[model samples]
Target: MLYKKKYSSWLHRINPALKLVLLMGGIIAVLFIHNVNVMIPLVAALAGMLLIGSGQPIGRVLLFMLPFLFVFVSTGSSMILFGKGETLWWQWGPAVISRESFYRGVHIGLRALSFGLIGLLFALTTRPVLLFYSLMQQFRLPPRYAYGFMASLRLLPLILEEFKTLQKAYKVRGVDSVKGWKGWWQKLRLYAIPLLAQSIRRAQRIAVAMEARRFNKSIQRTYYYRPGFSSEDGLMVICWVGIFAGAWIVGVQWPLFEITDVRFNE
Candidate 1:
């Protein structure tokens, strides 16, 4: 299962549709509100949500965040160094630092962190099958499209297993002469051809089976599992909206972190 089924947290019980909405909404809000002060708190709230939803230890969560943190800081630093603004804090050759640029960089970094946390929260809490079911049932997604997408996600582990089996077979045959980047590319080509063939065969078989079952004969279909909205989903939506509104208000109140249109003015 993609989601941890062992936890009975409120987040785990919320509807997958609502979780998706929250994820998209948070990202959209972050994109519009470019202020570190506001984004920092939003990031913290998302982290807290993830912790509560996943019921994972802080260390584990932080470990998962390390990679995202690296990406966030690297991109933010680039923006700080290269972004244009007035009131230069420092200048050396091709590098320049300005107060507005620094703030913008921090804003972007916090936005990255916030987005990561929100995305992780959804991924860690919601099962892929549940998401597909929710989309089809709640959002009126076409069953063919939803099932196709879900099948792709379910195929990922099978593909990995097939790759591993191929590697073991190669080892048993004593054909393990590949090394380095070029060798890796060669190995990838070898693997890709077989994998593609296998995938095509599997897809053909699936299509035949689905056709035999008359899956495409009708646009309407019955679902074995139907996800429904609950009171918890409503509460979660309210909380998400309130938090976003509060963050925006706080951002507007903080004059130091306000977004300045330096490029247009100067």
Candidate 2:
């Protein structure tokens, strides 16, 4: 929301096809890079893009990434407590935990966090309409599907707003009134019913609108917004290739994360 005018962001100015390619390449790199050190540069590249390309403030990027960071740490630590391997580092009677598992956990958690940030970067920099257009052009997606995708995109923010209002209303009405399991059940019911009803109503309206526009009447349509491929698009493809190449070289060749064998046996 704090992003600069759409066109002003560096990411916005770059070709959408390139951004999408870069994000995909980043995802693969994160998957293979077992060490955070190896990931740090890649993450930095994405962060820099978010800051300079998106014209988004640094604070916004940090705030967006905070929740994923918390999840990564919590989940990684929890995995270490339950996992077993050759490099056993700790034990609590029945459970045997290993150092190898600890590092593995770290890898998994950091990768998840990196993925979350990359997704946020993509969403922040890309306009829904532009993305739809690119998908249609590059992938040859059907117009009906593209329009349906756009329709859903249009309502996503509104649905989120509605949910927030419901959450606030529950707080005001004292969701704790019922207490314990019953109270929790009441909260779920209160939130679920209205949300489901609203979703159904919204879907029906969208279906009606599509029919009115004769969206399904033909497989072809005129494009008001056409995207042209250029040298910039080529550059984006190169960027994607570089990401995969860099991560592969670092992960397989140098081995930043070392695993010490610790087989547990009395």
lDDT of 2: 0.69
Q: Largest lDDT belongs to which candidate? A: 1
Q: Over 4 Å off in model 2, which ranges?
A: 1-7, 32-41, 48-52, 94-96, 156-177, 251-257, 260-266
TM-scores, one per candidate: 0.88, 0.75
lDDT of 2 by residue, 51-71 (tens): 665566677767877798788
Off by over 4 Å in 1: 172-181, 217-220, 254-265
- Model 1: lowest-lDDT 10 consecutive positions: 255-264
The digit string of per-residue lDDT tens for model 1 on 1-266 reads: 43567655777778998789877977887787745676766776777767766776667767788888897898789878888778699887888888878877877787788878887777777888888889988898877777777766767788889999988988899876667998889887879999889987887787778667875543568888888988998898888897788766765676444563322246
Q: Residue 84 lDDT in model 1?
A: 78
Task: Give the Cα lDDT of each candidate.
Answer: 0.77, 0.69
